[model samples]
Structure formats: C-alpha cells, structure tokens
Target: MAAKAALPPHSPGIATGAGWARLRPRGGGAMRGYRYEALDGARALAAQVVLVSHGLGMAFFPVHSPGAAAAEWFGRLAVMVFFSLSGFVIATSLSRLVASDGSRFGVPYAVHRIARIWPPLVLAILVTFAVGWLGQNGLPLLTKTGDAYRLDAVAFLRGITLTFAPGDATFVIDRALWSLRQEVYLYAIAALAALAFAGRGARRVLAGGAVVGLVILTADRFFYLQSLALFAAGAAAAHFGGRERLRALARAPWLGPATLCLLGAPLLFVVRPGFIDAMSDGAGFLAYQAALGIPVALCLLGLAIGDGPAARAAARWSWAAAFSYTLYVIHVPVMTLVFSLRAHLDLAPGLAGTVATLLLALLGAEAVSCAAALVVERPALFRRILFRLLAATGLARPAVQAAPSI
Candidate 1:
C-alpha cells in the first residue's frame, strides 16, 4: 500500500474547500505537494540521450552497424519516455492549477502551455533559418527537403499553431518539430476535454463539439490518435494511483529487475521488420510506441511515488531537465549545421572525422541549449517580474505555477 493513494489524481475535483472529493485511488496514492524530482531527471535524460544519439550519427553512419542499431533503439526508448513523461507533467500541472484557482481551464493553462512550446520554438525556427541562409546553404525558397531549411512559411505556421497550414505535416527548418506538431494537437484535445468536464450547460456543450471536431480533423493524421492514447495512459497513471499499483506489483523484489526487459522486449518482437517502415504507417508504429509507454508509465509511477535509492538518485538530473525542451527543439539545427560543415574542417576521414564532428556538434549544441534554457525556460527573475507587472496592470489572475520546472 502506498499510504493513501485512494483516488486517481489525474483530474481535479469539481467542488472546492474541505469537502472536495478525492482524485486518487482508494486512499492509496495521495500526492505530497507534487514533488517528483525523478521525472525531472528522466525528462532531461531522455532529451540528452537522444541528443547524444544524434550527435553520434546524424543518420549518416552505417545503419546496420551494431553501434547505430543500439543508438537507434535507445533513441526510440527515450522518445517513448519523453511522451509519457510530458503527458504526466501536463496533466499533473493542470490538476494543480484547478486545485489552486478552481478554474477547470483558463489563462494560466493556455499561457503556460503556449509560453512553454512557442517562444523557444519560434526562436529555434529563426535560428535555423538564419544559420541556413547566412552561414551556409543559401538555397532557394522551395528547395528539396534535406538537412538545412529553405524556410517553408506554411511549415513554420503549422509548427507554431496547429492550424491547417498546407504542406506542414513535416517541418523543413527543424525536423524535430514534427513530433512537436503532434504534441500541440494533443494539448488541444486534452484542453477541450478538461473544459467539457468542468461545470455543465452551454459551455460544456461547446467544448464537446470542439473535441469532436478536433478528433475528426486529426483522426487520420500521423500518430495523433495513438500518441493520445499513450499520453492518456500517462495521465491515467498519474491520477489513478499507478504508484500504488506499482508498489503492489513490486511486492516481489524480482519484479524490479524484470521491468527493464518488460519495456525493451516489445519493440524487439513487434516492430522488427524495419522500424522506418513501421513508423511511416500510422497505427503500428505509434501503437508500438504506446505499448512501449506502458512500462515507462509504470516506471514513472514508481519513481514519482517511491522513496527508494534509484528514484532519489535521479535528482542529479534535475538541472539538465530544466532545459531539456530547449535542448530538444534546437539541437537538430545546431547539429545539422555543424555536420554539414564537416568537410570544411581539415579533420581525418572515416572514424576520426565522424568522432570530431560528433564532439563539436554535441558540445556546441549543449552550450547553446543550456544558455537558451536559462533565458527562456526558467528565468525565475523574468517570470517573477512578469507576474508582478501583470498583477499591477490588473491582467494577472491565478498564480498557476508551471510544472515545477520541466
């Protein structure tokens, strides 16, 4: 038993005050002020690991080599973790907002989400475009898709807003923005659902209609639905005492070691016949990714609730986690640019050249991402100043803090 994880904390209680209903499992998984440091480490670790993966080989190395294969697998696993963790973070943050200010959905939610994804994204796009146009590749507007971007206006708008910008299913400036596009739509659908679940009447009806419309619009799109299922699984785990359940399942000590293989094996068996082909097809790839998320959710649930050594150990990663998103969105352009300019350097060919480029790219990307994260992601002073300015000007409302930094 995890003490009091009685109800699922996924959603917020509608009523306020002392009489508010429980949102966790039957008195088993009570939250202790939303402190999950392990997730911070996990989130940053995922991004950094993927960055390392790309740094090792930006799809330029031999695909079938053992090192490349292992790198790719780790990349897949990290992405799976990233999605589930993101979902958990977003849901928990929303629940926290509702608990504090009592709005089902409002400015804080919209602002936090928008502010989190957009500023850095726009900056990344601009940075990518500038580096491509001025530093190197001065290609025409509609050049064929490759490393650097020709800056498709439609793609940029699509990446910024989930609007129907034709020719935006993929991002030219930064290929990393594709999954981000999926995440934006996921945020939209989830937000609408929260609105519908809030107080009743015409408002709820409109929210429901919006959700239906969103579903219909995004149904056939790439991994949209499957990713939602994975995200909701994370949300469910957070709200529904997944930690308590994890403890129950981990009653036997052996269960802990088994969990690693539990997560790793599914991809080996299910998506074997070329991961690329599976990824292009809608259901199977994301479905496998969703399946992969199961154990990740469990692992996250355990870490979020447990007081064991491994869970607490992740606290070290909290620092890196703070800027993980910045690292993720910008690393691609930063990396691709360095890689493209490799021929200019007087480095050795073969192993030495690859190693040199990887080191330079990785080092540069990390430095830039860290600096960007400081300014954009967690400028505590900046955020405080903004809040005070808003409050003074009468625009400030709920003090809805973001999800404890990353």
Candidate 2:
C-alpha cells in the first residue's frame, strides 16, 4: 500500500501539457471539500498486524491442531483487514491521482502500482522455489502430500504466473498469493474506472456497481466476491468519506472502539463447537466472510480519519508498514523452514514449543523481509550497481543527471 498523508491541503488541478489536468475534484463534490494527509503509518501498522497474526497461525497454531482454532480465527480476521485495507489504499491513491492529474494519471498510476507490487512478488516466487526444493530434498519442512515439493516445471510456471483458477489443485503453492491475485483484479478494475470515468460521481457509481455486480454474480464464490465487495467499500469511502456527515462519524469517539469490537467478536466463536463446521458448510463460509467484511470496512474508515492514540502510535512506526508486504509474502516459506527444523529438533508440543517456534519463525521472517526490502523492494542500490556494470561493459553511457532517487 502506498503511504502518504491521509489528508493533505487541497489544490486546484494542474494541466500537464496533455489534454487532462491533475485530478482535482470537480464542482462541489464531497471529496473536493475534504483535505488529506499521509496515512502511511496507519496503513503499515495494520498490514504488520495481519502479518503477525498469519505468522502466529502458521507457526504456533495450525488450525488442524488442538487449541489452535483461535489463532486460525485471528488469521482469518487479519486477512479480512488486509483485503479491506488494500481496497482503501488503492482507492485513496487513485482518487488522489485523479484529483491531481485527471486522465493523465493513468500511466503514472499503473507504473506506481507495478513498481509497488511486482518486485516483492518476483522475490517471493524465487523464495518459494528455494523452500520447495529444500523440502523435496529430505527437508521435513512441509507435510507429505502428493503435490508437496513435487517440482513440476509446469506447476512452478503456474505459481509465478498466478494463473490457477480458484479451485485448482495447483493453487496451494504459497497460499497467501491467492489474495494477491484478487488484488491484481481490483487494480485492473480501478484502472478501468480511471480510464472510463471522467468525474468523481461517475467513478463512485462504477465502484457501487462493482459491489452490486460481484454480489449478484459471484457471491457464492466467497473468496472472489467478498474481496471485490471490500474493494468497492474502500472505493466508496474514498469517494464519499470526506462528506461532513461521514467525517463527523469518523471522528466520533465510539466509532473506533465499536469497529474494534465488531472485528473481534467473531473470534469468540472460534472456541465454540460447530463454529468452524458451520463455516465450512456450503454458502455458510461465504456468508461469514461477507459479514466479516462489514466491520473490516468500518475499521478502514475509522483509521482513515481517526486520530486516536492507537492510530497515532501506528503512524509512528511507518517503517514497519514499509516492510509489511515483504513480511507477508515471505512469511509462509519462512514458516515452512521453521517447521522443518522443529521436526528434527523434537520440540515439545505444548506452549513452550509453540512459543519457541513462534519466536523463531517471527525472527526468520523479519530477517528475510528486511533483506528483501533492501535488495528488491528498494532497488535503487541494485539499479546503481547495474548502471555501473552496464557502463563498464560499454553498453551504456552515464547521463549528466544522476539517476533520480526513488
């Protein structure tokens, strides 16, 4: 997610020599009247929390294991938060781009999206391959399954392409990537909106229509439709969140706490008998995810405008937010490695083993994430070295201007 102030001072649109000017609000629209500033810290903090929950679920609390139901529930909630936040951030960024540059924002928006998502994704694929190779070579990292560590070139290609259909057996590799596929679709939808809709009102209509369409057509495909709905919820927020009424609601002291309670309440059901079973039933899982999205969207709105102490604290740790994506994509493979080691270590199966394993996984994931950030996520240094290599080989000449810093 792009991090910048949630609200910044409003400025009139600027013409960029092209037909379109910057994306400024037209007429007396609700978005035009509201100011925005950077909300990077909050966005990052939320993402990090999701990563932590996912890590805990994988490392300390496998769902099939006894006493792990709560962890599994927490992981599910964290994913809901992630999808909601993804929608919000993408919508917010697109709104800002449109307001600043009008139609001309399309190319830059696409470039920014590509830059933000692809680098870490490439690194993740490589990491997944390495981990799979290890597991195949007598590493006890993964559970023995027909597909586990069976490195068919075709399967590897499918993984990197992220082309598996929702129910395809090949989709299991790096299960977290499923959300990334949804995100890509959302990005395309957002891009289409940018290209086709000239006004904020029109874009809002598009977003609303998407929610309705997805609900009508794919509701039974909960994983797909729910994400689209959440994205639409975020887009709606971007379009109308600035209205005086909504702003007031956002600032209401009860809003933040209420949203938290709504999000947390589902966890209580994790320990209840038949809760998981109910969710597993046809349509039941879909309904649960849809219901869960309501509060997730509300939480996004609260964070968008909230100035609570918690929000402020989250904002302060923006660096963590920067690493959030890498942490997320890398954690699963790292956890697999941890699990493999645990098997050999003959670790006890109680709280002590769980805690120890959790710590190890967390630390390993963080280390890999940090390295990825330095090498792949922020590639300026790598680019510089590449430039030097090219120059050495007489393949290119140095420009008078130093390469613009990222």
Tens-digit lDDT string for candidate 2 (1-406) = 3221133334222223322233332333434432322245655565566556666666555455434666555555666666666666666566556655565455445545555676787778778777777766776565323254345676666666667543332354466677777777677776666555544566557655764564566555537776776666766665566566765666677766777786667666666666555544437565667666655555556555666675566557755655777777767777767867787677758778878888887788888898777766754444455556656776534641132222
Cα lDDT, all candidates:
0.61, 0.59
In candidate 1, what are the lDDT values of residues 6-30, reduced to their tens digit? 1222333223332123343454444
Query: For model 2, where is the 10-residue window of minimal lDDT?
Result: 11-20
- Using all chains and alpha carbons, the TM-scores for the candidates as numbered come to 0.80, 0.76
> What clash count does candidate 2 reach?
23
Candidate 2 displacement at residue 365 in angstroms? 0.4
Best by TM-score: 1
- Number of backbone collisions per candidate, in order? 21, 23
